[model samples]
Target: MLRLDDLTLFTRTAELGSLSAAARELDISPAVASAGLKRLEQQLQVRLILRSTRSLRLTPEGEQFLAHARSALHSLESGRQALAGGKAAISGVLQIAAPSDFGRNVLLPWLDQFQQAHPQLSLRLLLSDHVADLFRQPVDIALRYGEPEDSSLVALPVAAGNRRVVCAAPAYFAHHGQPRQPEELRGHNCLLYMLGGRVHDRWSFVRGGESQALTVSGDRVSDDADVVRRWAVAGQGVVYKSWLDVAADVEAGRLQVALADYRGEATPLNLICAHRDQLSKPVHLLREFLQQRCAELLARVPWA
Candidate 1:
């Protein structure tokens, strides 16, 4: 009989593109992991992974096998969840990935509260401005500000009313003068943020059913979003940022919204998971908790 654990190890190794990384994630030794893969291949009578010193790649057979492997795992998980009646005790490592500023400032505290509610549940958080791959990484779920790029994943609506605002520090506006229209932003210095290897210099806004993308320039650019927020706070330049990121600064008189009448369309916040059927009990509970607490907060914000 083929062991399900071996098949799972194979899937993780294939997804991560490394045997050692998958072994480390599964808390098994490298040699043991290698042996398990070998055993699985022997039973299946086919080579699964093409391994080299530099990297690991799945064979044609491996690629086809992976789909069935994941589906089988998902079905098993679904059966278990059904048996437990959706009230299973939330235990096991719940891995999550999220952006930096929002993760640290907002979601981090809520995550803490969730953990407190379920003492048995463990957590592993990967906070980065760069978007994390749910399949490639070991994370069970991700919190993204915009729509998911990958169609393979399932995105749960976390916040629908969250919006991006064009803003600048009061000092910056006093010195450079705030722009009244979207086109005027080209004359002012605009702080830029780089995400996924592209600089977000094109600021978009919709007014009276017309949308425009204003290309702006700046002196400072950073890959880390939190640093960009800091630069905006220091009166370095005007910035196009999420309202949740600048709400405190705006309320405290540190920053002021510019061209509020032409604010950009709201982007939804999504809780993304790889396979809905495979979603763990902790992930389901976490999604519900976030929808109740986090989504409500953003929904109530006065965007105008």
Candidate 2:
């Protein structure tokens, strides 16, 4: 029989694509990790991975065995949880990636409460506007806006009804006036956000069966969504952002909604994992907690 530790190492190495990364995660040295993989491969009588100085990839045999390995590990975990009377203590380092604005402004406090509730759990959060490669990166999960394009990944909805909103600070509206329609935005300085090297200057909206998408210019642009939001809050320009990102500001009267009659694009928030087996009990609990918190926050905005 294959050793469970070897199985875990194999899965982690395959998921992370780096022996060093897997070793670090497991708190072992690279030499030990290499020895374990070699032992497993020798027993199986097949080379599982092709490794070089700069790249690593699985063999076809390894690719086929990966599913069975993951399933076996998941089954063992489930059995262990059952042995604990279905209340296994949640204790592990949960590495997560999230959008910059929500991660810093919204999720940081909520995560603190979560950690307080489960003191045994640890967290590593990566905040960025760029999409994280789940297979290549060290993160175990991601909190992202919009549904994932890759249907193979599991996506748990945190806030499905959430959408984008056109907003600006009261001072900005006082000076430049609010754009009543999408077309009028061309005359205003719209704060733009950049992602994956593309500048998002186009704003789209729909109202009463009418749809419009207009490319709006801006005096400033930033790759970080949080920066653009701060610019908007500073009364620098108009901003089109997720309602969740701007909801508190709107409620506090720092920012006011523009084109309330027009419905902006949907931006449903989701918790994404690369594989189903990655959804442990702790992950499920966190998802539920976030769903409740987001619902409460969204409820405060009557127009959203």
Candidate 3:
């Protein structure tokens, strides 16, 4: 059987990327940390890592073993916390990953209140437009928009909202002329989003109970949603985006929603977590808080 101490040491080492770093995190000496890893490798009869003066690299065996070790460590720690009655409280680090736009405009602002409510909890928030691999990364929870393709995760629909109609600034509309039908968008300058250099230029529209999809081409394309919104605001081009993302600009008359009668389907936002038989108190609290907050946000949507 693998020792819990050795597993803990191994996980810390992998996470910190060096014996000295792991030692600092675990409150042990570098020699002790190195010795613990050596003992673990000896017991398993497999070399887990390749060390050099400049860097440490994981062997293929180590990469595979780390997954099992992380899962096991999580289970062991959870079990220990469960057994430690009386003071069985939620007081540990919680890591969350979310999309940049949503995280900035929605979630991050509310974190102050959550932090106040749970002062004992240490929160690590990672914001990126890219999806994070929860199993590979140490993320405890993720807030994702649109439908998730992965069925292995437990997803809770937390918010529902509509996608915005393609819109442009009044100045741009005056210069390019307004598109009366979805097809007319082909003649206009459209701001597009590029995912890894491939244009995500498809615009979905609903009109007279019929849905249509338009493939648009544009001179400017960006991976950043904010950049697309800014281009539309600056009268550079038309942009199809979520209302929640551009509602304030639309309200301020910086941008106008084109093809007004043709709005697409409401996208459901979700909170995802690793599937477990039981959830920890911190996870439970965060889920409830997000659910309530999302409900409140959705209720204020003008198109809802």
Top lDDT prediction, candidate number: 2
Tell me the lDDT of model 2 at 163: 82
Q: Give the range of the ten consecutive residues with the poorest summed lDDT in model 1.
A: 295-304
Q: How many backbone clashes does candidate 3 have?
A: 0
CA lDDT of 114 in candidate 1? 95
Which 10 consecutive positions of candidate 2 have the poorest summed lDDT?
Answer: 78-87
Model 3: clashing residue pairs?
A: none
By lDDT, the better pick of 2 and 3 is: 2
TM-score of 1: 0.86
Pairs that collide, model 2: none
Listed in order, each prediction's TM-score against the native is 0.86, 0.85, 0.84
List model 2 lDDT by residue over 166-236, tens digit each. 99999999998888778898888989999989999877888888888988998899999999999999999
Residues 1-304 of candidate 1 have per-residue lDDT tens digits of: 8899898899889867899999998999999999999999999999999998998898999988886787687678667767878466767667799889778877888989999999888998999988887655667789999888889888888776788888888999999998989899989888999999999988888888788886899999999888888899999999888877777778788888888788575767789987776566778889889878765566545445
The TM-score measured for candidate 2 stands at 0.85
**191 in model 3: Cα distance from truth in Å?**
2.2
Regions more than 4 Å wrong, model 3: 80-89, 160-165, 169-180, 248-255, 277-279, 302-304
Off by over 4 Å in 2: 11-30, 44-75, 302-304
CA error at residue 204 for candidate 2, angstroms: 1.7
RMSD of each: 2.7, 2.9, 3.1
TM-score leaderboard ranking: 1, 2, 3
